[model samples]
Target: MRPFRATVFAAVVLAAVSVSVPVAAAAPGSGSSLPGAGPAVHPDNAALDCPDLLVVAVSGATDSTADRNPIEEETRQLWSNWVGNITVPVGEAKSRYPGSVGWMYVPYPATYGLGLFQDVPTYQDSVAAGVASTNRILDEQKTRCGDRTRFALVGYSVGGEVVERVARELGHRPADAHVGPDDVAGVVLIGDPYRPAGVDSLGAPGPSGGGFMSSEPADYGDLTDRIQHACRPYDIACDAPEEIAVLELALGVLGQMRFTLANPLQTIADAERVVSTMAARAAAHIVSGDDWWQSDESLLDVLRVVADKTRPVPDANLGPDRLREILDWAVGPGLPVVQEKLRAEGAGFVEDNSGVVELVLKPYIFLAFIQHIAYWNNNPHDPWYWESEKIVDWIGALAQEERERDSVGN
Candidate 1:
């Protein structure tokens, strides 16, 4: 499979909550996927510049080791990437953040971590913790920066679902939990599993809702469909799996991409090769070791296999030049092609839950590939062409809206 990459925006400040700022919010999945506890947000819109954004990441699928590492790496990468990406040049200011871009996630126990991935219970707990942490971050920001700060949200994959839940909670903040009107600029849900009703500007959601939730990478019957329909202009197979943490993850339990390149394996094929090698080496090491110090023959094989197996398949190019390339792709122009490709690819991608969980075992095998698929098909940062143009437009529009809102109120 090829590596495809895609990657979105926002800004708002505290206003009198007079004019209704229409924006898409995230809604959580119920049943087994639903996390426990409700997030707490207070309606404090007294800040000056703009509202901070709440960025939530999903592990993709499964709750295991393979998914965790990538998530942490992705987060660090994303933060650095976005911090730089969002930093508008004086001339480019009006292009992206017509208003201002400020966002944050509360870092509760597991709410906001360097990288995150987990089971349903762990998810719920994390959500609860995030809500608490989000509140804390906002409160802290408010204390230091003042109240009434505008905000927005970006949820990746299952992380998108978490974002949805938070958005819904934010929208329906109990009388006690209140936030400003444009507190959330928009919920940029990338590869979400489920799309709640009445959302504005919802990104890609698969047959099972909206997200890159694959039972497993090996079970990619739908991938071809997604490529054919979602990425028509370019070759989806040639894009690159490494991009998915920004491409497909942001939803899985481990959110391997979010793991901050914690356990990067470049591509699924590469992952398979690496793990296969690890398994072989581990087996040989155990079998030949005469000393009991390296013993434990009974479980050594299983441990070796599992260890080698739990690695995400992403093509991480953390090199300075590559990172710069990504930034360039994100900021440059000509997005219609990418957007159209995504629409086509995303429209055709299929979803089959048949033993998918068992196959994917957290979907690490193809996390890299899927991430590329999801993003190239939908994200604005796709390098295949000038896809970033659409993002620039969106940012310009949002900034204009905010400026208008502020001007009128003043």
Candidate 2:
């Protein structure tokens, strides 16, 4: 609405906030990274939480249990995989942690697959809501765990975007954060596309790298193609391959910038500063119902905003059956073995301390290596085995780490 606001004083804080902690890019910070990122991350030798606690938040993807039917077994498998499933590849981190850790999956009402992700009036506004929600969750959890518990935030897909928002919001002085380092250890994001709000160019490309199919990988071209074509009326991004001969599209706003809309600062210090400042602003906005620049000026407005963006997905290409198959394959069979492996990672963290975290992602785009394949790739019996499941497993693993961490401490 307002002219993109390059004039905001927030940029002044941006430069000073980007410092690094002793933690490597992959590790927790030794020094504070984001303002509220806690004491440090990648505290290799520090006494880490034996059983780390995790709060796994999923955007409400399904209104009721309807959509979940396909992934019900998988959800159970995921549950077993973390709490106990042996068939999963990643071991259960909770088992190794004892009573010290656990993971609680927050299931919101799903608005189709996009859920509330699409509901944020704008990604920035959604970004604001996510920041508020994270801090609120931390506050509640801190009260629940008292001073003893150390924690982190793990988000998948839209949830990952929430994590990024929290990171950016706390980009100032995390030390002064409402949610102390002792409560929330760090934040972990998975399957995040990090696209900017309302930027049309950011949509996925279609196959043959030309039409609506340019951004999508060629390997699953057929399935995605059907989805694209089916979605033609609803989504601006969804177009048929045949339509490619007519027009060309540009990349989304996020496509121009490599950094996430959630956190723009590259270094740890900057991230902390921005987030802390956001925390301060968010606190004020919460208290006074102000700050419409990014926030919606009121809590109800934010909720309403989140509601507006979500809509139904028309394409059912990889619906219940396919999703179920994916879940079964990833979480079935060696449930005990899988749990064991995840537990092993917890064993790696034998002590307890605190910190922040940030991952400097590679420039690689999602579905980057997809090759041109026939329609058969969509078939469950095909060999490709639907690598999307593997990526999904990665999310499970990331969340599992937090679960295991929480388990060990108690």
The root-mean-square deviation over C-alpha atoms between each candidate and the true structure, in angstroms, is 21.6, 26.8
* Reference-based TM-score of each model: 0.37, 0.32
Q: What's the C-alpha lDDT at position 136 in model 2?
A: 54
Return the top candidate by TM-score.
1
Candidate lDDT scores, in order, read 0.33, 0.31
Can you write out model 2's per-residue Cα lDDT over 124-187, one digit (the tens) per residue?
3333344454555455555555655555455543444455445444443356555544345444
- Measured with C-alpha atoms, the lDDT of residue 269 in candidate 2 is 43
Local accuracy of candidate 1 as per-residue lDDT tens digits, 1-410: 11223331111111112112111111222112112223321122112233332222233222112112211222321222221122222114442542244333322223222322221223334454344444444444445543334443444433444454455556544434445333444444444333322122223322221223321222212121211111111112222221222123323323221221233333343445545655554544433433422333233223323342233223343457765764565356525533454455333332212223433344435343333233422233455432223333443455455556656766
Instruction: Report the poorest 10 consecutive residues by lDDT, candidate 1.
Output: 10-19
Instruction: Tell me how candidate 2 scores on lDDT.
Output: 0.31
Candidate 1 regions off by >4 Å?
Answer: 1-92, 95-99, 105-124, 139-148, 174-177, 180-182, 196-368, 372-392
